[model samples]
Target: MLTNRRSTMPMKHVRMPSWHAGSKTTTSALPTYTIDNTPKSLTPAILTSTTQSLPGYTTTRLIGAIHGTASLTHKVPKSFMKSLSGSFTGSWGEPKPLTQVLYQARDQAIERMTKDAIEKGANAVIGLQIRETEVMGCIVVSVSATACLVEKERRGVKRDSAQENPF
Candidate 1:
């Protein structure tokens, strides 16, 4: 029973549909998806039979790709934006020394992304991607990563550093 009126209607196409809108889906394991246009779904027809398992670490679950974004505007004073002193990295160009602004924006973006993952109980993030853009005198950065919990296989024992071996 769909309570939201918007959900009850036939959903408008948003990009290519990953799976049929009204079908019982089989992908009960995948938790996240990216906007990448990679080779289409891995159908059973092309299934590889020789899959080998790796060791040392086990992936307990996939929480999906969590994302965070930050935007900063270095409002350029009329003089700064129009003046020749800080404007232009080369001999000729338009507006302000942006190297520092870019750095700060990028760092803030990454910090937010990691904070998001931590808040969601992710031990680590993988497949990280950072994107940036400059628009209307503002710099915007966004970062995304696959957040998952990976547990390491325990060995025989872990000894404390201060413990002496009773040989």
Candidate 2:
């Protein structure tokens, strides 16, 4: 009487969501400057995409590397908050609690860098980098920049008098 017995079970398939997109990201490279040994008077040189001119000097070797670092620790003051939101409308009243403090630190770092560059007799600065670090309960902002004296090669030939002089 037990002719045939069968059990039927359904099969289920589950699919998970994906988080990858087809776009690719790329990073650009930084430029390297050649250091010069001889000290050359600082002059403002025009920067062109095709070529960069270094200071004009005989010895084109690295003389010295000057760097500046600064750190600032500050607590947000109530006075700063009052001024944060000018009488202007559509303004976010005052900066978030901690933002105002950070801004102060950034300004302090920049000022220090400027002073250091001037003291080192550097007319222009290159390879400027900045970083902000949080330690303990205080935030530390640090900035670093390279100051160097550059020289350019002098052309041998000088312009000669014109064949015909115009009155």
In candidate 1, the residue pairs with backbone N, CA or C atoms under 3 Å apart (3 or more residues apart, or in different chains) clash, namely: none
Off by over 4 Å in 1: 1-58, 76-97, 153-167
TM-score of 1: 0.45
Across 10-127, the per-residue lDDT of candidate 1 in tens digits comes to: 6555454456575433442121223552212221111111122225655566667777787876655454344335455467753223444455556566677667777777666666
Query: How well does candidate 2 match the true structure in TM-score terms?
Result: 0.39
TM-score of each: 0.45, 0.39
Q: Report RMSD (Å) for each prediction in the order shown.
A: 20.9, 20.5
Error of 2 at 29 (Å): 40
Once fitted onto the true fold, the runs of candidate 2 whose alpha carbons sit more than 4 angstroms away are 1-65, 69-74, 79-100, 150-167
